[model samples]
Target: MITRIATLAAAFVLFALPAAAQSLAPYKDDLFAYPATLSEADGGAYRVVDYREMRDVNERDEVPERRVRKQYISLGVRSQQQEMKLGTQRFVAVGTQQGASMIVLYLHGQGGSRSQGVNDFTFGGNFNRVKNLVAKAGGLYLSPDFTDFGDGGAAQIGALIEHFSAQSPGAPVIVACGSMGGMLCWKLASDPLVAERLGGLLLLGSLWDESFLKSPAYKRKVPVFFGQGSHDTVFPVEKQEAFYRKVRGKSGNYPARFVRFESGTHGTPIRMTDWREVLNWMLKS
Candidate 1:
């Protein structure tokens, strides 16, 4: 195991500079990046993104849900939809399986599965962009099937993190949680072991937990990115904004960010969050 880890570390060093010292190499910024930033604060950590359904969704997709074609997906990346078992936990990993310099895991919301995170053409192909970015950057992306959103599921996710992290010893693990998946994110944040492994947390159109203010991850100052839609009916945006303010108030220098998509709905963040920009910020935080 030690020899394998050493080999992975060597591979990582050759892949790119240490994650802390550099940002992710650009993938397709011209196509996948967010539109004009309406406003920003706290050194650009907090901002409002101008989101229009006509441009962000209708124009980008050839047929909305049915197809996005070459504009959104690159069929070349090695995105294996197969399952890997860690004890009893199962997951679908996209990108390099071993010797990764960075690790990203997307936890789907209620009514979503492990497949949701790896789907190339869905969610405006945001997931596909993430797959390509990590692969090109020599990293790993995981979409796991968990039992529940409570302790059991968080433990399952934590175990997966431990297993992959062992393979890529120093790789930073960033968990991007959507909607109900935020429950698991908060649970993981409260766990010291998982918290130690986390480079950051991306809450996309997700709920907030007041308890997070006292979590181990918070104490450790783990960077956090909150992307929400201003018009979200489920999990009101105002409440989320209040929470972001509290996080900032708690620590004047905490590595945290909030991106509000004006006039967007509940699923807007998943479809619109800029993976490259946010992940780079966390890696360099």
Candidate 2:
């Protein structure tokens, strides 16, 4: 069963790569066509990487290296102290292992809870394939319940970022926000501390808010993994691509990838192996 799933995941990966490169080609000329006076290195623009190359890199033959068997262990009852509380909130840790060097914080969507996030992020006990990659590299995963909706929840998310960052000083923090969680993620990006601490951002079925996108802190070298569904009713691929173009317009060499899931809805993109692939990249790349 695992073998079959792996095969299917590889197939999906092949399909996802095309969307990464093709999504913003046409907009490049109109969006990033600056005069020769402004050099790309001077923050004008940088050549967009060919997404197909990622596929080639994955195809290379590799040694049979030892891997940490991913185990979804429960890390007991946890809660946010009143001072840091954005509102009544709690969280649960789910991953193959735990440590300080690398941490992944997944923010749930509107009305979403850790219960739903755990099952969704882990694909209901199939275990994240990337967990081994992360564990071997020394990292853990965290999923939190955002009872506070809208931008009001940003502070709580920031508090969590602060907590984890403080726990592991100098550790790279990666935030994977889905749907409404993306809103809070953007709000957190505006914060100099949170923006400085983030190693990467993953937008799953979420749109970009230009308010923070154009900020200097956000425009830094932090990588962004954008996952979108062609069939997503709330926020379609068009919106994701538009956001990508907007960001790419300002920062040419920004490490942003658009992973498209064909015929997928709002939730399906979150259920793929892509999450682990991107998470590992954010941590180990």
Candidate 3:
């Protein structure tokens, strides 16, 4: 049964990759791109990025958590904030609705709502950049609100993916989970259906699951990107880095990448992650 599932998983990923070839169009390439890299390892699969609060936060935000530079946002993107009866869940949808070439979904952490992923001003306008990239590349971007970070929430997100994916057949689904939202990411990975549709998994300032080694997504070779902060207090960076190393070693060098933000804290990865760079890599892989 395991071998049969793995074969199907690989077949689905291969089918999904070709449609995701068109890379994301540039949007504030100079401003949103990652800054200087501090170090690199494992042939560039791992990197340490230079991050400073004074520059990445203070200089970018006008009121810390309230607002950001006006230039960082492009309000013209056609985004619809609505509720879907699929699971009675609320979500913010951006970019093309039908026949989308790709699909990107952001699942926010605990104490956050669907709006957090669509906030153009906060998080150094990182969310705004993703919206523009998806819109220009003929893709769909969704940020949804779920009941909790458990099986119930995973079912809600899975239903959302199935509904949108039906509208845009063969579009690769790349899920990005922040903080506690990683719980759903792992759960989705274990789900055979969701695992088959996934192009990649982005764990931003999130946790790890040991069972992932035996998950269908692992057998499918779905790419994974980990963004961590060296100084994160909520979830220690060491544990995540250790798990990342284990994943690479266990999978004989899996399609996984890690980016460590030197001196950054819990929310730094959410604010500093280069969505274009990460998404493009997964699309091509």
* Cα deviation of 206, candidate 3, in Å: 0.5
Regions of candidate 1 where Cα sits further than 4 Å from its true position: 1-22, 79-82
Model 3, position 244: C-alpha lDDT score: 90
TM-score attained by model 3 = 0.91
**TM-score ranking from best candidate downward:** 3, 1, 2
Clashes of each: 0, 0, 0
lDDT of each: 0.83, 0.53, 0.85
Candidate 2, after superposition: displacement of residue 281 in Å?
A: 3.2
**94-211, model 1: which lDDT tens digit per residue?**
6566667788999999998888898888788889889888777777889988999999999999988988887777889999999999999999999998899889999999999999
Minimal lDDT window, size 10, model 1: 1-10
**For every model shown, what is its TM-score relative to the native structure?**
0.90, 0.64, 0.91
Candidate 3 structure quality by residue, lDDT tens digits, 138-179: 788899899999999999999989888887888999999999
lDDT score, candidate 1, position 138: 75
Off by over 4 Å in 2: 1-88, 94-99, 120-127, 130-136
